[model samples]
Target: MAAGIQQQNAAEDIVIAGAGLAGLAVALGLHRKGVRSVVLESSPERRTSGFAFFTWTNAFRALDALGVGDKMRGRHLQLQGLRVMASSTGEIAREMDLRVNGKLGPHEVRCVQRNVLLQALEEELPPGTVRYSSKIVSIDDQDGAKILHLADDSTLRAKVLIGCDGINSVVAKWLGLAKPSESGRTATRGYARYPEGHGFEPKILQFVGEGFRAGLVPWSDTDVYWFFTWSPAPSPDANGKEDRSAAAMNQFVLTKMRGAKVGPEVLEAVERSEMSDVLAAPLRFRSPLSLLFASISKGNVCVAGDALHPTTPDLAQGACTALEDGVVLARCLGAGAERGFGHEEGEDRPCLGDAIVGAGDGEERERVVAALRRYAGMRRWRSAQVIAASYAVGFVQESDHTVVSFVRDKLLSGVLAKTLLMMPDYDCGKL
Candidate 1:
C-alpha cells in the first residue's frame, strides 16, 4: 500500500454514521474509554426532532455510565407512577405505582426532552468530533477498510464503521437486512407549554379507547409532552407522501379525541401544541424473528440502535435500548482492541486507535471483526426480546375486541403493569 493511502486510513480509525442519541452516546462512551472516533451526521445541525421519550430505569443506568445521568435526572421530575384511564369514561382504569425499585433500587423514570438530551451528549464530545452535513450516500467494503461515499462527492476510509442511523438506515440496507414493515399505526407527538406553570402530578397519564391510544407526561413545571397513536394508519396525501403538516396532524389529534372522556388538561395539551413542537410518523419495526438471521454485523462494519433493531414504542423501551446499545458496543470494541493487540506501553492498556494502527493487517482486522461480532452476539437476543414484548403489549392493549379489552383492563391490568415495570430492569454493565 502507498504511504499516502496508509496515512489517510490512519486518520480515520473509527467512524460512526448518524449523530443521533445512539451515535453520540457511542462516541461519548468511546471517549470515556480513551478511544477517539468521528461521527458523521447528514443534517445541517444537530437534529432535535424526536420530541421526547420516557427514560426508564434501564435507560438511566446507561446514561449514568455515559456520565450524563445526573445532569438529565436533575432536569426532569421523576414520574411517580403510571395512570391508565378509559378515554370514554374519564375514569382512572388502573394505577401502577412506580415508587418501588424492586432489585434496581428506587425506581427511576422521567420524560426527557429529546433536544436537551442531544445537546448534553454533544457537549460531552470533543470539539469537531461530529461532522454535520457529512452524509454517506453509499458504502463499500474494500479489503479490510470500509469505503464510505459521502453525498458531497467526498469519501472516507475507516478501519471500523458503526452505523447508528435510524430505521430507514442506508447502512442497514447495505448489510442485506430486511426492510422494516409498518405496524399499521401512526403516532403524532408534541409538547405543550404553560409559562404560568402547568399543575400536574409527576405521573405518566395514559388514556385508551377502541383502536386508539394517547398519553401525556409532565416534562417540567411549565411543559408537558403528549402523543396520540391510532390504528389503520393514515394514507399518503396527493403527493404520495406521509402528510407531515403540523396543522393537519395537530387538528387530527383534536378531532379524533373530541368526544372522548379524557380530562380537560389532556385536550388543552394537544390544542396548545405549536407547529414547531409537533412531529408525526408512521410506526414501523423490523420483525423480531427476522433478527434471528439478520446481518447485524459483517467484517468490521456493524449497526446499532434503530439501525439494528427497530422496535415498536409500545414498551417505551426504544430510546432505552439504544442507550444500552451504545454502552455495550463501546465496551465490546474497546475490550477487543486491548485483548487482540498488544499494548506498547508495557502494562498500560493501549487506546483502541493506537491498538489498530495497522488495521489492514489480517490479525488486526480480525480483532475489529471479532469485536463487532461480540456486540451483535450480546445485543441480538436482548433486542429481539424487547421487540417481541413491545409488539405483544401493543397487540393486547390496543385490541378492540370486547374480550381482550376485558382481560387487559380488568383481569390482568395489575399483572401487565408489573410486567411492564420489570421489562427495563437490565444493566448495560460498566463502561
Candidate 2:
C-alpha cells in the first residue's frame, strides 16, 4: 500500500521481480530485442539448491531464440527417449522416443543442472542487471507506472512490471491471482556422483510402483540424477515437516526404495549420493480451469513462469513452458516498441527508457496494455493444456484405488507414446 508519492525522476522501462530461470530468461530475451530491465532477487547471492531437470525440444528452441542454445547443448547430457518400467517386476512398460524424425533430423532432450542453467543465463546479462537481496515488500499502480516498495524501504518505479516469481509469488497476490494448491504428493530428488564412472545408458529410466514412482537419468559419465515421488497418508501433518537432518533425509529415501525392482546400478548411485545433495518437497500445481479463467495482466503489469501457470512435474513441462513465456513476452514487447508505443519518431534509442516512458500519456499506456494482452492471449490456451495434462497424469500415477492403478498400468501405458507425440511444438518466431 505504498502510494501517494510522485517524484520527478525517470524510472526503468521494465522491472522484473525474482531472479529465477523465468526472470533471467525474460531479461536476456529483452536484451536481445534492444531493451533493458532490472531484476530483483530476494536471495543474498546466487541460488544453488535444486537438482537437474529435463529440457525438451521446445525448451531448446526457446534457448536458441535467446541465443544460448549451442552453449547449453554442449554442456549437458542428451538422451534419446524415456523408458517406463514396472517397479514390481522391472519389466518395460512403455518407451517415449523424443528424437526428431524425417527432415527435422536429430532433436534431443537433455538434463541440465539447475544451477548451471541459472549461471548460464546470469552470465549472458550485462553487469548490474540483477540486484540481489532486494526483496519486494509491496507494489502500487499509479499514474501509468508500477511503484515497487523494497524490503529495505527503498522504491523503484517502472513503465512495465513482470512477475517471474515462482508459485509463492507476491506479485501474483497483488494481482488477485489464486494461490497454488498441493498435488497431494511429495517428491525427493538428488544427484549421485561417482568418482570413477557410472556405465548407464543415455535414457531416462522410470519405475512406477504401487502408489509411488521413481526415475533416474544419467547426467554425465560420473553423475546421475534421481527422483522418488509418493502420496503420504491423509492427515493434518500429511505435508510433513522441514528442518530434517541430512542423515535423516537419506535414511528416509533408502527406506522408501526398499524392495523395489530398481536395478543395482540405480541403488548404488543412490547410496553414493551425498546427504547434502538430497532435497524433498511436496508437489503443488494450479488447476487448468483457474489458469484459463484468471486474468494474467492488469494494465502493463503481468506475470510469467509459475506465477502464471504452475503445473505438476508429471510431464516435466513446468520450466519449459516458463522459458517459452519469457521469449513470447519479449517478442510482444519488442513489436510494441517498433510500433512507437513510447518513443518519438526518429529517436536514437539506447535503452528501454527511450522506447517507453514511465509516465506516458493515455494513448501510450493503452498501447502497452495491448501488447501485454497479446502475450496473455498467446500463452493462455497452450498453458492450460499442459496444466490439465500434468494434473491428469499425476492423478493416474498416484492413485491408491485398484481400478485406477490397473487402468494406468495397462491401458495408459500403451497410449503414452501417442499422447506425448500430440503435444504442441513451439517456435518463438524471430525476435
Best by lDDT: 1
Q: RMSDs, each prediction?
A: 4.0, 4.1
For candidate 2, lDDT tens digit of each residue in 320-397?
Answer: 888899899988887777655433224566334433444444556677788899999988888889888877776776
lDDT of each: 0.83, 0.77
Model 1 CA lDDT for position 424: 80
TM-score of each: 0.92, 0.90
TM-score: which candidate is best? 1
What are the per-model numbers of colliding residue pairs? 0, 0
lDDT of 1 by residue, 263-320 (tens): 7788899999999888888888998988988889988788999998898888899999
